[model samples]
Target: MGRYRETYERWKASPEAFWAEAAREIDWSKPWDRVLTLEGDLSRWFEGATCNTCWNALDRHVEGGRGEQLALIHDSAMTGKVKRFTYRELRDKVATFAGVLQRHGIGKGDRVILYMPMVPQAVVAMLACARLGAIHSVVFGGFAAKELATRIDDARPKLIVSASCGLEPGRAIAYKPLLDQAIELSEHKPEACIIVQRAELEAPLVPGRDFDWKDEMEKARAAGAAPACVPVAATDPLYVLYTSGTTGKPKGVVRDNGGHMVALKWSMKNVYGVDPGDVFWAASDVGWVVGHSYIVYGPLLHGCTTILFEGKPVGTPDAGTYWRVIADHGVKALFTAPTAFRAIKKEDPAAELVKKYDLSKFELLFLAGERGDPDTIQWAERALGVPVIDHWWQTESGWPMVANPMGLERLPVKYGSPTVAMPGYEIQVVDEAAKPVPANTTGAIVVKLPLPPGCLPTLWHNDEGFRNSYLADYPGYYKTADAGYLDEDGYLYVMSRTDDIINVAGHRLSTGGMEEVLAGHPDVAECAVIGVADALKGQVPVGFLVVNKGVNRPAEEIAKEAVALVRDKIGPVAAFKTALVVQRLPKTRSGKILRGTMRKIADGEAWSMPATIDDPVILEEIGEALSDAGYGRKG
Candidate 1:
């Protein structure tokens, strides 16, 4: 048997012992009373322990004689600037920042909201919060004021850290206006705001409430202020990440201190196969969970050099920017969303830009945050000539639930699957009645409770909401809300969200399956399939395709071919007939296709503009395309 199966079986035998062994990698101020404990349905790992995440991530490395080693590399393609910080440098910065926050009466358990762009200060602020045992919630930079206000009210931060402006390809988005608006709109007003004034755009600060970030840091440094790391209990709240709830109010997924550090540090070597000192880059924004885990904590805790990239896959100059960053930094592994690769593939179909840089040191490419379509995965594999592993997890999980553990074993690649379940997750596919389904049969995917370490203990301030959201659906399992199945060999194929499964005349079909077929089309760059209301078949699948940049063939012809491909591959049971060629698909800032919104548009149902949409104009374009295809509202 492979090492993966052996390790998984061992973990299954005794989860507490497995986690205890993993805990050894972390530095703790006080040992735990127990490895695991259960209170009703909620499980807590490493209870009664005390540890400071900032100490392990920064100070530990510095004290271990790796002070000169590079800790963070902030590379911004938009600004054409690069900043590097050694372990010692970063540690000192974090310590001083912690002192700054301390001076502002921020301490353990106090909440701080970070509303900054992909800047080095954002990283420092997060570590600073951890150093003081404070809980930090990072709202995505440049979010709509109303959405930011909602989070501000929910998290109720004592202090807010923000940048003056966030840069796009050719423009600068002034965040001060939005931050000011959110604060004005919020009922729970924060005491202070620290605004990072960027060179691109310097925002006017409020007279009393807003303080200049640079001035505060300088004052703290001049005073030789450095705060010592504060020890907190294992189960103390580390961070609260908000994921959109069905009820419109966002759910704050709470991650704990000890378990989070242990799981993420373990994942660095075990999941990505990267050693200490190796440069690892997660091309994601810190506003998202991937950023919170990999870009900041994971790499730092593992003593790997992490990159903070502030650019797009295609427009940050060119599609060659990613290759350039890898070649220049000698990045050993890169973890990014599949949508990024799709964007790159769309612009550079032949992967010609890849040849411009030397990526010999780049060994592994991990894709998450979206279903990694087989076509995109295959294209990435061919382009990068490295293992393109697509892992599966969620904002609540904080770490990967299912992945190909490259460090433990290099398992055989499966095109659509994210390989097998990790040691901690006992994934099972079950039908609506909660009965286990046969292998390869599509159903709701769930994890047998209690969930392992690093996953959300509960939603912040809402234990009942947590139970209702995840646990109530499955009696003894954590409802993943994802629909997929495991193969006979135990490899998981995460096809789509549970709601994405469409029913056609009593037959349930996966829209992700249809999307996979459409993506496989030779000229298609990216695609999305959503089920629209149809009187004839209950619900029929409609596809939207974004063809490759250079493909000049008639859009109608290509759309017809895509429809045929889906009909042939998924069989006529899909009822997949219509495919519209569009310039782009509407996506959130995090690159998730807004299928629900598109479905609403096609069904002629009243739908509000999504707050997280990357561009509002894209939805208008999509609506027009649907109308031309005889789908959307006649008006």
Candidate 2:
């Protein structure tokens, strides 16, 4: 009867009903005849449809009385200032940028690489590309020059977008320096780069090849031509996101328009419970699918005010940066990773930063990225007096599957469920054979039918790569490769990744379970527990840690307490093979620690394996600490 019920019914009535209905809410020059068509192994939603996602998300919102209302709130971490952009203002900016692309022969289906910080304009540029019907590939802002260049070469985008200066944890890095390097690597770099000037850093403008973003916008406006309407089908490519390749080269995962729009718009309303006036902050960089969905397209299409803050969550002056922005903006919903929760919990728990901000304004606190430790969620809820939601999804599936329900959070968290496959998604916990697993039994988490938005259609340039990585592993079902068990209530509790599980004497334990134990300790700030090769136990868990900044305890003592904490939390079998406290954990830019690298460190090898780690130094730290502990002598 209401928005939630109607939305649920609309989805349940038919597999493709929800997206078909949502499509009507947007502007369409031409609409599809059928909702979905399944032929052979392929499924298409809104087949033969024609519409512009950017027009629905931005331009139409400006025309629909919500134009003057703020749609994006920029909370600058480096400057400690907040900037607001209204729907109308956003539309104009996007139109201007789209115009810039038009001037450079950029049109429908062209690839554009947005390698910039989490500033407001970054989102603006992304939407602008969408408006022009171009496929965007946003490289993680923290990626070194080499990583950025790799993606640039992969997509072969015609343009590379960067800020004159961008925010980093401790200080601003000269972004153009990296942009220059990426340009050198880009096979299809534009004749001129568009710089979203920020940080007030001195312009290291590459002579004759870079253009001021603001000035270019003025030029586009002065020409005053009608916005170009590039002909594109509804199912046209929207983005190509690159996930870290477990093998050598990263794979570019491509997502189509119709599915992305429907899945994200619906998830935003039902999952985050995003409302018209709500200020949402998906504290993820634009590089990942999370940013593509919640941060950019989803929130905008829902007609909500969202935050686009640039800088690290922990050290933007202090650990309180996230809290301060929420209070200042009265952000109603927040989505971040467990990595941040565990990492920040290492800071002064009762510091004045806690007392300085009022988090009561936020209605929902959501967790994704990695397993949401029940321990972390509970502490955050208690400290902030708000229910914390933990959701689970992947780069491949595109949209959230398991999560705290956006429109139904009051139902009470089931502690580890991703909230029952989300409404339109068909999620299941299955065995190695891809058959459904019984309740309370751990197995692979898989999606059944009708892939949701934010889900990649295929690997950017490789079709079989997508099928092999996601579809081929478990035929007929998109195997997530994450292990989990569904509770009696159908709540899915994701264990760590399949490789992240530990089997010792027939007892299987998740890294999350061990992490929950390590985090429960009062002295422990943050830790990583990885299963390592052990001839006796088959495989055992080892703890690598970063203690609180000023803790006077010696490394050996911290390691001792860490093991005791793990033992107490689970059982004696949870003991570490070798516990080492390090200066920092090696993590991807997204805050996911490189556990595979940790596993290598425990094997007493040189840790020279370049398989999973972005940085090789974290392995070195583990090696030095292990050497000092005399673990080798004990062997």
- lDDT of all predictions: 0.94, 0.75
CA lDDT for candidate 2: 0.75
List clashing residue pairs in candidate 1: none
Number of the top TM-score candidate = 1
Model 2 agreement with the true structure over 104-146: per-residue lDDT tens digits: 7778888888877778778878888888889988877656677
Lowest summed lDDT over 10 consecutive residues: which window, candidate 1? 241-250
In order of appearance, the predictions have TM-scores of: 0.99, 0.92
Q: Write the per-residue lDDT of candidate 1 for residues 1-635, one digit (tens) a residue.
A: 38888999999999999999999999999999999889999999899899999999999999999999999999999999999999999999999999999989999999999999999999999999999999999999998899999999999999999999999999999999999999999999999999999999999999999999889999999998899999999999999988852245679999999999999988999899999999999999999999999999999999999999999998889999999999999999999999999999999999999999999999999999889999999999899999999999999899999999999999998899999989889999999888999999999999999899999999999899999999998899999999999999999999999999999999999988888888899999999999999998899999999999999899989988988888788788888889989999999999999999999999999989888889999999988988888887743
Clashing residue pairs, candidate 2? 270-406, 270-407, 271-406, 391-403, 398-454, 398-455, 402-418, 403-418
